[model samples]
Target: MAQDPRALLAKADKQASSARGGFSLFGGKQDKLEIAADLYTQAANAFRVQKLGREAGQTLEKAAAIQQEINEPDDAANSFVEAYKAYRKDDPSSAARVLEKAIQHYTLRGNFRRAATHQQNLAELLELEIGDIPKAVAAYEIAGDWFQSDNAEALANKVFLKVADLAALEGMYPKAIERYEGVARSSAGNNLMKWSMKDYFLKAGICHLASRDKIAFKKALDSYVELDPSFPSMREFQLLNDMLEADDGGDAEAFADKIFLYDQMSKLDKWKTTMLLRVKSSTTAPKPPLLGCIEEDDDDGLA
Candidate 1:
């Protein structure tokens, strides 16, 4: 027979209360705390089975607190992560909060890989759950740096690309270009990533255009080819060159035609679609101001 969740919760609560209250003749405070933490974890799992995420999360937090009190750092961190998992669906705010606690624990212990993983997770939580773009970018950047520190170049580059994507969305074009260009330059040496070079460079070019800087945008193209000799041969280079001419004349149609051709060959992702649209919008010349009160001769009838 399944144990009643309410009964399990009550039993866990009583055990935790007794552990926190005082020492006992049967055992020391640490022993009592261990038992209480175990019971709390058990109850938390039962609550999870019942889909009581909030209750499970809170109960798991109690276990984590007791684990910390008993100087079980690893257990405490694990409990905190478990609590975050439980709270994610029902209470994402609490989930992010506790997940950060676990991240801090891993960071303090010099666990860069774990820190990087959870930091990336935290960044997604901030990005997707909270809709906080700036904080999410910051967290993602930290995770990328940590991954780099851990010698995980592939993971670091992936996270850095995400930072670039979000930064471009926020209209921070220079920041986005820097990240994209940086990754492109770094990835140039890797044979596996060579094909992706044009993409990164293309994104950086679009971001430069999105910033509406024609001169710098033109210069960036030459710089990209220099960074990787193969870049000029790619279709991306031709597309950028086409857009540059269109931008000079403020010809929206010309710019769009170039994008259309490029899209047919290599489909643009959401980020590219957004950036290209920005570039397309900026290609139109601003309307001349209305001329008011223009002097005119009275029918010019030799008067």
Candidate 2:
């Protein structure tokens, strides 16, 4: 007898329905959950064969949920990831949702590395697909923390930089500066990343200027100089020093003109351009309360 795909799908569905009924009768029994998960998996396969991607994704997600309930978190995470893959071609939002579920299950199962990977994936999806910068930053921060916990320092630092970049774009300068500074300090011993510390310090100083916190900006400049005294000779460093001097000398227009001229002449990259533009805007706008006072917040307490 020839096999009928639709008949198989219907039978799988019936099995799933029976398993759902058994949930009420069996009261969260592991065996019942296993049966349900198996039935849902079968239904998902049938749906896939029938080219019903949405149904396949839904069935797979159901199986994942049952697997989670039955304490099979690894299985649940894999199923959720499969569901995400099934939905990704047609429904990005649904795929992202399932990917988040997979991340959650992996996290709950103490699989920090897998959790961090999924978190990074979700962050990229939020940033590129959804265009949600704040949420993307939050996701990236979580991923960075997980990666750090897993001793993936390089990956963690990369993710932390992403969070800082997004925070700067969102005008969260203090947070951005803190995160950038955090990565710089943490990478102090790594030869490959040490070179980037000066750039991070420069960016953090730019963030301070963007927040109109001259004291913080000066402190950041001092910190950079302490790290690499030659920083004072760099063109960017000189530009920043000139701005601070103009601010001190009460030459607002000169400061503004200097920024404008440098902005035009430097042909800065997108990140630098964005940071400089933000500083320009802040220079004209009324300064908010000081939030970047790194000195007072820094507590190298008594030995």
Question: How big is the RMSD of model 2?
Answer: 9.6
Report every candidate's CA lDDT: 0.84, 0.76
Instruction: Count backbone clashes in candidate 2.
Output: 0
Per-residue lDDT tens digits for candidate 2, residues 1-303, read: 434535655665665566567546544555656776886777787777767777779889888877877788888888988887777666768989999888877787799998999899889888887788898999999999999999999999999999998899899998899998999888677888887876787778778878888887877888877776667777678788877776666555656556556655554456765566555544543432231222232243411
For candidate 1, write residues 51-156 as lDDT tens digits. Answer: 9999999999988998999999999999999998898878889999999999999999999999999999989988988889999999999999999999999999
Off by over 4 Å in 2: 1-8, 18-53, 69-71, 88-93, 246-267, 284-303
TM-score of each: 0.91, 0.75
Error of 2 at 42 (Å): 6.4
Structure candidate 1, residue pairs in collision: none
Give the winner by TM-score: 1
Instruction: Provide the RMSD of all predictions against the true structure, rounded to 1 decimal.
Output: 10.6, 9.6
